[model samples]
Target: MLLKTDLTSEQLLAVIFDYMAKISSESKLDRVLVLMANMGREMIVADRCTVWLIDEAKQELYTTVAHGVKEIRIPAGTGLVGHAIAAGEPIIIEDAYDDPRHNSDNDKKTGYVTKSIITIPFRNNDGQIIGAYQAINKMTEAGKFAPKDMELLSLAASYAGKSLESVMLHQEIVDTQREIIATMGEIGEIRSKETANHVKRVAEYSYVLALGLGLSRHDAEVLRTVSPMHDIGKVAIPDSVLNKPGKLTDEEYEIIKSHTKIGHQLLRGSRRELLSAAAIVAEQHHEKWDGGGYPNGLKGEEIHIFGRITAVADVFDALSAERVYKAAWPLEKIEKLFREERGRHFDPAVVDVFFAELPKLLQIRDELTDKE
Candidate 1:
């Protein structure tokens, strides 16, 4: 009941090359792992496949994002997969049930039978063992794992290790950037003595709105990372103006409005895409949809969509969260204000999308509630 392959070695190499090329374009960690698992299934002609990465901190092997069996973890040196990992080599088991190293607890738990398996080890640049790649129940006429299967699966696992390394390193850089962003945003907020977590809430809210407005995930992520700097310019404002308990006088209000330009000046001219996007958001977040707001009275579609989307997110989070000068507005009042300001203070499309996805927005707000 299996399809046999008549392809030559050259064809298999071509297939592996194509797999590498395809995965290169994927960046998300979960997507990359699932893709790797599916690729292994095809390469080894297996009925089921999975990838397990080591949790060095926990000294265990755990599933990444592979589908099928529930996410599982087993201590190092526990089973066949573990045995191959501990040995630092690929193992082709023709009869998994007879292998003393085979772990049958999973089969018993899932009510599934184990016939054959190939387990390969993944290594880092330093040749350190990092994880295991496994293919279950090879489906060819021979009905067993082959030597070539080990070589190909091992090569695929190596590619996966490199990809994982790239993604992890990129995440580290992203985390560092966020720490700096939060630090800068917090510094600005502290100057105004504004409530905590304002920047974080705005970033999350902006990301939600971006997705609702049909921005690509990459674009949404850019907004999520950059929107926190919307008020980065408050750093330069005098404490008297920034931290005023109540309403400000005319001159004070005018100075407060200048913070937008100040923020823009601080963030502009960055070669980094994140900073460049944040610069636009900082400069235009206060701009209005009806030609009445901001340092520049740009109206309608003239306002960069980034600013328009951020405007809705920034105000929604600001009003919902308790502020230094004001109590948190009830959800009823917030929804009414969004409805009332639809085309006046905010972009109509942005406001509509916000309400349409209210559940997700509220979940984000409640989950990331500000600390005391």
Candidate 2:
């Protein structure tokens, strides 16, 4: 076996760390896989590769690559991939057909032959097997891979394992953040008539609108979770103002409006991106495009972009909902208000995006309607 001496072990570790950092900060699963796939191909001299992640709960393996192949899930002890995971070790099969561990049925379905295979299990720092990373068909100068080649492949797999662990940690942090935001939203909902489902719908609506308005997915996600805080200030309002059957008295209305300021103050000090977004929603959701609404009456482009977007979402959702003071308006009536208020009470461009997927918005509302 001939070796390429472009990078020393120290250099390889540095490159692997760089890849791990890139994967750790990334949220999109596709981009993460693409980066890792390129790393695998360049770091190891391989041809025609596929990486499978193990789902132990489902006893399955899934592919993130779109190489004319979907994922294949076999029993834990069935195939070479499964065996590698079960034994928590790497498996190098020079001739897959001759090996008893080979599962040939998957290739028949995909109409691709597997000549050679390498499956390595990736374990986290805690010693739990998170997934398996596999690379198939080493394009050799000769007809086969040699012992030294297998050794290098093993080293590359070790780096890949560390990268996979970093991804898992990143995912865990994201899931935890989502749970916290949900709990906070639910708590705020209890202070009013809003249900958890209502909060969820508004969050989804905000996400769709932000994405349509060309916001990055990260920004969209932050706004999705934060938009629910628009009415979090209502938690501080008196029930006399909150549950008024008729329209609020001027005094009551002033008290009710103070919730926006209260919510803004409550969320303002947080260093978190979501809380910062929530603060914007709280402070400016009531602000008018023409400089008329809210505590500060911030006008036009002076309002934070997030604030403008959330203002539309918050009002649209409130109008469509059945509240203490009023019944739910018809979809047509809400649509008319959205159209009429364009650039006066709401951002016209955001409203356009909201209307573009109006059918889906109605469907979501119907799906998430409070059951009383």
Candidate 3:
């Protein structure tokens, strides 16, 4: 660790610029906190640093990234960080034990001694205080924080506040989009008299299957989010054909198959990655592995991987759960069917993944089982 006193003015400015660049490039909230914590620890030469954010909804101060700690949450107005937030200023305690505001519970829990502390309140671009940066046990001979140390932390906090706000806003938008998609998917399911849990189970099953098939965690999560919309086209389906209790006539069957094209057309306009992926899943989930399926009759590898994975997940749920028109098939029967249709109805590799991860898929089904 480089001490603040060791750096000349030019070197200090360069370090600050480097940190700013790194922080600016990151959009994830957790990664941004880690970068800010590291910047504070390095610039102040402290043994540990923590970035605490005020969760207004919970009225708590929480930190996911902290040195030598898993995750800790406290009341909004507790401890040194709380005091700094409450006072809307910086707090420099030469001896943590001597200060009435310092809390020793964390040190006791972690079996780590606390000696010196400096906390600075950070604000968003709107100039509203949002969180605080706290650095503990400055690595000096005296083990105390100085005025210069406070100045260094304050500089880091300024950049951190803005970056945190930006990432938080991005996360909020993503959450809202997910909620809308989920609701729309539920509407599509409800139109055909199916429960919303159908989509939920399919999403979870798709995630498990995706990971089991060696897809990256990010890609798997994206698939989970978009898989619910696979039947969004059902919203445009007529109740007579969609909810028919008896076997459908050939003409009515054709109308049912058109839902795929309808769903794809609904979502294909969006350039967003999630929506675009949903479009592919919506249009191709019914396509068979042997080129005998509907919409485009896309055969084998021509079917998008997203569609193929969802096909397995969708059929698994559809077969295992009770529907308005049919009783839920027994697990033994479903497994037997999957084995028989391995290469004809489904991708052979996906069917293999289905049996391989069957336990996890069953667990998900049990967890999100229909309410009846």
Candidate 4:
């Protein structure tokens, strides 16, 4: 903890400004909240800090990054932070247990005794209160939050509020785009008379495979969001070919294969990162590692990693689940096929990742199992 008296006022202001700069550049909400909490604890010289956001839709206060606690949710206006938000002011409690507004449930749950607390409501750009910053157990010799602590926390809260709002808006937009992609993927599946869960399972499996192959979380999430559209081209296929219960003749099969190019054509022109990725997945998910499989038969690493990973995920789901034309293969059969085709039908590394993440993939399958 940085002792409040150790820094001159100018030094303290410099430290706060430095932290604010970091908070402004961050795009992730959870990371922004963590920075805000760290800034509050350092400025106030407190043992811990929590940045709580108001969930207006749920009428609750939630904190995903609370110090020493798992994610928690409490009714709006239920605790000290809530009270501060409701009153639209800063609060200093020398003894938390003695205050009627303080909630001891967390203290009891964590077995950490609360001594002093200072909470300051934070506002959005419009000056409407959106959340509160709560610092606990002052580390100074006084062992209690002073008015100065409240002032320091207030400054941190003011900057954090705006940054949080911006990051949250970005998150909302990303979430909407993901939803639209997944919905479009489902529509394509439904057009071919396949279950919606097929797309969901493939997306989740692709995420597991991507992560197992050492893709960054953000990239893995991008794969998850767009993998559902691997078969989007199927929407363009004639229903007779797409939904044929019997074996497809060579001509019908060729027509069926054109969906990949169709899906790519539909999404390839988009400037959006999500759509661009979806185009790759739509176009090349069936390409073989040995230059034997599809539209262009791109060989080995020439295939986009996104397409390679989706191939394993899509094939696994397709083989393991019962389809109109075939019964679900047993686990042994699926494993045998994967082993035999490790470097032929699939990318060797991707096939390895699929087996490594098989447990998680199976869990995803069970969780999103298609309804009978």
Q: How would you order the candidates by lDDT, starting with the best? A: 3, 4, 1, 2
Measured by TM-score, the strongest candidate is: 3
Candidate 3 on 1-372: residue-level lDDT in tens? 444444567877877888889989987788899999988987877899999999999999999989999889999899999989999989998888999989899889889999899999999999999999999988866668889988888989988898899999987777777888899999999998888999999999999999999999889999999999999999998999998888999999999999999999999988777888989999999999999898998999999889999999999999998865789899999999999998898999999999999999999988988876
TM-score sort, best first? 3, 4, 1, 2
Q: Give candidate 4's TM-score.
A: 0.90
Residue 118 of model 4: what lDDT? 88
Q: What range of 10 consecutive residues in model 2 has the weakest lDDT sum?
A: 1-10
lDDT of 1 by residue, 1-372 (tens): 656763477877777777787788776677778888988887877888888888878998899555568788999788888888888978888999888898898889889888998899888777888778889887878888888888778878988888877876776677777777778877787777764577778888888889999999989999888888888888888888877877899999999999899999998997877788889998999999998899899899999989999999889988898754679999999999999999999999999999998899889889888776
Clashing pairs in 1: none
Model 4: which residue pairs collide?
none
What is residue 112's positional error in candidate 2, in angstroms?
3.0
Top candidate by lDDT: 3
| lDDT of residue 286 for candidate 2 | 88
Residue 185 of model 4, lDDT score: 95
| Candidate 2 residue lDDT tens string, 286-351 | 898888989898989888878888887777778898865579988889989999999998878888
Q: Which scores greater on TM-score, model 2 or model 4?
A: 4
What are the models' TM-scores? 0.84, 0.80, 0.90, 0.90
lDDT for model 3? 0.91
> What are the lDDT figures for the candidates, one per model?
0.85, 0.76, 0.91, 0.89
Give candidate 1's total backbone clashes. Answer: 0
Q: How well does candidate 1 score on lDDT at residue 326?
A: 71
